[model samples]
Target: MQTGKIGVTTENIFPVIKKFLYSDHEIFLRELVSNAVDASQKLKTLAITGDFRGEQGDLAVRIKIDEKEGTLTISDNGIGMDAEEIDKYINQIAFSGVSDFMEKYQDKAEAIIGHFGLGFYSAFMVAKKVDIITKSYKEGAKAVKWSCDGSPEFTLEETEKESRGSDIVLHIDDDCKEFLQKSKIEELLNKYCKFMAVPVILGKKQEWKDGKMQDTDEDNVINSVAPLWSKSPSEIKDEDYKSFYRTLFPMNDEPLFWIHLNVDYPFNLTGILYFPRVKNNIELQRNKIQLYCNQVFVTDQVEGIVPEFLTLLHGVIDSPDIPLNVSRSYLQSDANVKKISSYITKKVADRLNGIFKDNRKDYEEKWEDLKLFVNYGMLSENDFYDRAKDFSLFTDVDGRHFTFEEYKTLIKDNQTDKDGQLVYLYATDKEEQFSYIEAAKAKGYSVLLTDGQLDVPAVSMLEQKFEKSRFVRVDSDTIDRIIAKDNAPELDLNETQRDILSEAFQSQVPKLDKSEFMVDVQAMGVDAQPVIITQNEYMRRMKEMSRYQQGMAFYGQMPDTYTLVLNSDHALVKKILSEGEASTKETLKPILSEIKGLQARQTILQQEQGKKKPEEITQEEKDDLSNTEQNLSKQREEKKQVIAGYAKDNGTIHQLIDLALLQNGMLKGASLNEFIKRSVNLIK
Candidate 1:
């Protein structure tokens, strides 16, 4: 036996390993099991090269947990380290045996996982002491045992091992006894080694015996030696892919489609990316794409590896080229990462395009589920946008779908405005915006259903991409004004009549929370609704963007502003205006006369002030102008209050306002109750 201090620059390395080696202490199992598998694979490589004349028996990596003894052992039947090799690989903390093997057999070696050689030290995180019993495959080689007790001091001695392999025994620490539990170890194996290249055996297979689960003699393998992503796409059946998907996520719905990624030219990447059915909640679908390094699970938070939008996809991505740190918990920034991202983006776009081209009817059938993913990709990645535009679809409220170019061709003749811009009309809620959609359809315009979570930003991005095109919500404005081909008809009412009508209706508008209304009297046809509520497109989009974007919370805090458009040609509005004028003309006559005199003085004072420099103007002149403006505002407000008073008692005005609110799904609670009662009374 030979005992000595571990060759190290500092004695504090063991403490660092115990406390800060890994973010999670559970990662120690993954590290140890991965090392065992690497040894097995290295033995296979040597066997293939005719370097070893040994029998390649069961290469399965087995794990055993002794709860009473408080020891968890991971054993492998493969090439093991002799005393000399252990001294070189184990004593030297950072020297990697896998790296040395790869340098010699780069083309022949099977998936070798170790790189930093720090994986062995991760055992100290949860183990008070660790023992390695190994026997080399070389002829006449001696078995060796290495013991370390969570310190730089370690012992190396001769040991008896019948097989040519290694056994890593972890004496779990008192605070880390969870590693000794069978269920806990099995969980770690499932998460970190589910798709490992080597078959991993956890324990005996269980059977229901005498109304309870009992361990049988059969070995229970926890990992698949060859996952679906590791196979050729041609060899995999559609049902097989779906079965694998169910194995990955048992609770999710059936995927719309999947893309088999197998590229070796630019960078080594292989995986299956499934396009899951993404509904309204985009956030719930993130972090599903698992990243693997040579089939060893690295992480599921593959944010920088794939495009941000592709995070919505669910599947596995295995690539040896992706750079990782010692822990392999986080991805490191590298040029290969960006290359992989671009390659994945291209593959996704290509798969979508292929599906669209091959079976457009089927693509349309799946569009409802695929819209969120495609829209997100187009909105977030410009390169993806360039490729996705051909396959991305625009679904109308009538359940009809069209590609961007196809929709452009279908509507270019009629939906083009006088400015030669193609107007794309869309609606968010089909039932709530039914009236607006009908109005747009009456004008022979198709209205798309832009109701996805990302549609707000996606529409904005499309506006920038489409040439001379704009996306307008069907309820954003009157159909005639939204895609105006001719000048609007003039209103018959004068300015005072229009102002009175606006004020009267505005007074009757419901006081909704976080909402403001601006009354606008338009000369819509007599058949049009008396009142229609529409939101400003830019402000509404900004508010919607605040839900998904950062640094835009100010828009979310602002009150929702809507335009209450009253058709001047409609009978109800005309009658209201006529009655308001008849009732308030007598009271507003004196006020109007006073306002006119104050306004004349105000205009004269403003013109005089504008001609003189700020220093030349007298303070008394400024006061006179200010006084005239205040008086004029006071008289106008008095006239409005008189009109508002008349409107306050008018149930017709209140009913019309409530009707518009109801159409937009904004009338709620007490206000909605009031509208119902008033509607019944008016009917009676």
Candidate 2:
């Protein structure tokens, strides 16, 4: 036997390989199995190309563990290398200047495994000694045995082999003895080679003979030669896709639908993306998509390869074009990767559009399950928005669905406001906003159910996309005010009467954290509730967006603001004005008179001053104006006390406010309890 140093400039290659060659030493098994797969695939290619005339008999790759000998071997029946090929590919260290390479790359040793075509050397990461015994398929080729003992030096000589193939034998180091375990090697094989094109046999098949586990003579193949995604879409059925989905995500619920991606034009990309039934719990369902390179599993964290939203989809994406091992920065900047991303986006949109066009009823039935994903795609990908624009639908509270264009036509005439804005009404909680929805329907308007996580941003996007169109929450305002075709009927009460009633209602407004209420007198025709709480759609949407967005945290931190609109036509409010409890009215009348007199004086002073600046006005005039404003403010405070007195005794006012609060799902804690109690008392 003759041995020569591995032609390299550095002596510490073994230690560097052990410590940093791969982030997870467990990956050594993957490397070995992958090499075996590549060998088997090469043999198949050679046979197809008419280079190999010999009968390709049983091209299965086998992994054998010899615990007694303290060795593991991966053997494949493929085109084994000759001495010349071995010297060129294995002996010569391709990386120039080993010492500098090690020092510069030690920190990234794990990342460097695949960079220098060092897949074979990765065996040294776990083994102290490695041996390759092979007989090439070429004519007049002799069998050879090559051995290395954890150093640059190696020995190569003639050997005896039964068949034309290669055997990679690894004498596992004492520190990595865990690899000796059968379960460990099997796990690695499953991870990296489960869907490879060639059969990967692990051990003998097990049988439950005699009601006990026993090994059979048959070889136990651990991989599928042809995975689901490799087949034509026409040949596959829904159950096949479902079965494949189970293979990818065993614990997940069955997917709602799947998109089989088979594209070979711009770039070779093939995969199946399944839309799982994600129910409100978002974090649990994310990061399910598995990314593969040439059928070898690379990562399930495919955020770099796929759009941020599509990461929620579960499946296997295999492409030789996408590099197996690279930094996220590399994938992001790679030209082919960008093309692949665009292709994926187009494919997903096309699949969705196809589903919408082929079976709209089925699409509508699945809309509730699909809304979150569609909304996410629309918000995250502009291309997706452009494609989904025609097929994307608006589902109403009554369960009827309409495309964006269809909905526009359905509600254009009635929902269009005097400002020529086509108002798109939507509700978050159908049950909670039932009254608002019904009121909108009464006015010949349809209310959409915009309740998904991405609906807030999507609504904002839709408003921008549709010209002269605005999205209004069903309960954001009264039906008449949401899309006013013409001016609303004027409230009959004069200035003094309106002032007294306004102060009476405003005084009783609840002081909750971060909450502000504005009292509005609406002639809502007595049939409406006395108090209806309406939120500003823009502010509410901004607050909702703040929940998911990072920079908008300030909006989320702020308390929700609502408008406390008082319907002047309601009987309770009319009674509050007409009956006016004596003790409360006595206290309120004088304060009202004082405020009216102060306001009259202030108006007279303002008219006299006319457009003049404070400096231009006389000191007496300025003082008179300031005193009138102060007296008016004080009188309003006094008036508030009278309304508070009436509110304290009047269950109707408290009940109305509580009802509005309950409608908005905002009445909580002790206040909610009080509202419940008041509701019960008022019903009695």
lDDT (Cα, tens digit) per residue for candidate 2, span 107-174 = 43211113344567778888889999988888878888889998888998888887888999999999
Candidate 2 residue pairs in backbone clash: 6-152
Candidate 1's C-alpha runs over 4 A off are 604-627
lDDT of each: 0.90, 0.78
Cα deviation of 637, candidate 1, in Å = 2.9
Q: In angstroms, give how far residue 270 of model 1 lies from its true place.
A: 1.3
Q: What TM-score does each of the candidates earn?
A: 0.95, 0.89
Expressed as tens digits, the lDDT of each residue in 1-684 for candidate 1 is 999887778999977765665778888888999999999999999999999878999898999999999999999988998999999899999888989999999989999999988999999888889999999999999999999997889999999999899999999899998888889889999999998888999989999999999999999999998999989999999999999999999999999889999999889999999999887778889989999999999889999999998999999999999999887877999999999999998888888899989999999999888888888887778788888888898889988888888899999998999999999999988998999999888878899998877787888888988899999999898888899876767678888998899999887887788999999988889888999999998899999989888999999999999999999999988899889989998998999889889988988999999999999999999999988888888888898899999999998998888888888888899999998898888789
Q: How far in Å is the alpha carbon of 592 misplaced in model 2?
A: 4.2
